[model samples]
Target: MFSPQPQYNSPHNQGVVDGIISGCKSFCLQTSIHGFNHIAAPKRHWIERLLWLVAVATAVWGVVDISLGQWQRYRENPTVVTLEKDFRTWHYTMPAVTACVQNRTNQDKLQNAIKSRWNVTPESHPTKYLYYRRFVDVVTSSDLYHLEGYEEFANDPDLNVDLFELVVELMPEQRVKLSTAEQITTPPKWTPVMTEVGACYTVNSLAITDVALV
Candidate 1:
């Protein structure tokens, strides 16, 4: 008669099994996903664990269903292009155009404005003139990214320059005419608007509050 075989459930084997179970429990507790902890808890009843399993399955199914529906829709209608024969007769609105002048500021006008406002010329008050010039450069320069340092000048009403007036005073005198369908039409009025780089002018702008018959 052969001796009884040694038991397969050795201490080392049992320890490895326990370690796996402990790792799974720790993962369930620390994970951000909901319902996993309830399923893994040792004190939870069988019925409660079953309910959590069903809930998690339902949520996963919902996400998968929505993904499939979107994919089907894309496959059905990938893209559509329609061409019109009489496209010339169709009415089309003119596109708005914004223009920024190369010469953003006029030195002569700035000097005059500063002298008129403070009653002091650059020659007499060199410090004050330099301060104003620095403010203007910070506001008008396109390369300067951070404006936090210039908050004082930006917030001060006394230092603020009339950007629109400065740009208009130096604007070159010119006439604009529009022609459409071999007929002369009046061009859209240029509206003054302040932008990141100082005063800019826009034509056929919807931002204008007062609607005009063009």
Candidate 2:
């Protein structure tokens, strides 16, 4: 009788099965290369936390930089830009005027500076609006003009200067902010104050101080 000895599984086969099981367990613990799976939660959470921190820090730095006024570049040139804006706003509905200015303080070197420094004639309107407006405001100062002896020309230099100055600093300078008079009604609170007889005044009394915050 030929007895067939049952073939016994070799150690090599057993080893191969063990290796496959170990590999499968390693893949599960680390990552599944071939199937849809989940990433290790701890590593994912760490990355998210780092990103959130960086975002918050960036936002805080941005706010601080703006508050410090470190980014201000054109702030110094405000006088010119502001004057232009006010000119456009005020004259939008009204007819524009020609204005002239002479240096009252430079009396010693009058004729020389008048020729070199002054571009516009005493009563003639300059072509440039910005220059004309500023010249008018400064030349028209009551005291300054009085010294320049141009007071004979009749115009409201004082009132004009005050208004021009007021407009220039209205937004940035606290002193020039719109007065309480501005908020109350349509018409302005104070009219141009008249000097005793014929002279012009620059600024008038505040009809509305309520606009200011102490």
Candidate 3:
């Protein structure tokens, strides 16, 4: 008689059992989606974001300031020619010279010498001679001095007007790029013309035509 009535779960018990099963399933699903020990990705705090922004801004400002400072320094000190009598301010070792240009007379002498040696006389070819003198001054002046700063003496009104004119004229043409005096080798066709005097004389003779492109 006692066993005849099979034990039956009450509504509350059945509901509890169902709830346990549902809970277990939910737990399993959550574990599968996020590993049992997985750590959530941390969110960036507002303070951290603000600090990063500040750091980036500071770095950018520093770079801009440094760039502007360098530009200003370059402008203040420029890279132009300097007419120095003792010219010891070379980037490389230079040979000791017996004399340095003191006045316009030195340039005149040089011009006359170039005319005599190269036969580029002002009377014969005035235009050629003009360009020839310009090239000579540019090469000689830059070769003998520093090129990254303007010397105070270069700004004098009476100082080397011809030299200044030559540099200014050639700046637009991009022909004043050479920093040192280089001896140009004679071409095979012109080698015989220089045999009588020397290669040096030959190079000087052809320099006018080469530089002037005339």
Candidate topping lDDT: 1
- The number of clashing residue pairs in each candidate reads 0, 3, 0
lDDT: the better of candidates 1 and 3: 1
TM match of model 2 to true structure: 0.17
Per-residue alpha-carbon lDDT of candidate 1 for residues 1-214, written as tens digits (9 for 90 to 100): 8899886768998899999989978987788898778878788899998998899789889999999987887677655213324566766667676666655556657677567656667899899888876665555543235566476576677765564454455443324444455342665677655555445566777765442211
Model 3 TM-score, 2 decimals: 0.20
**Position 128, candidate 2: lDDT:** 40
The best candidate in terms of TM-score: 1
Candidate 3 — which pairs collide? none
Question: Each candidate: RMSD to true structure?
Answer: 9.7, 23.4, 24.8
Q: Give candidate 1's error at residue 184 in angstroms.
A: 5.4
The 0-to-1 C-alpha lDDT of every candidate, in the order given, reads: 0.65, 0.39, 0.44
**Would you estimate the TM-scores of all the predictions?**
0.43, 0.17, 0.20
Evaluate residue 18 in candidate 3 and report its C-alpha lDDT on the 0 to 100 scale: 92
How would you encode candidate 3's per-residue C-alpha lDDT over 1-214 as one tens digit per residue? 4667688869999999999967755664465443321222136576665665566567768989999987887777665313323355434432321112212124446655555445787888998777666555543445333443335344544333354333322322111112244332432121111121111112224433542311
Across 79-155, the per-residue lDDT of candidate 2 in tens digits comes to: 66456565433422222221222221223333233334345444554354344444443443444224453443247
- Regions more than 4 Å wrong, model 2: 1-44, 70-87, 90-214
Stretches of candidate 1 exceeding 4 Å from the true structure: 1-84, 87-90, 142-184, 196-198, 210-214
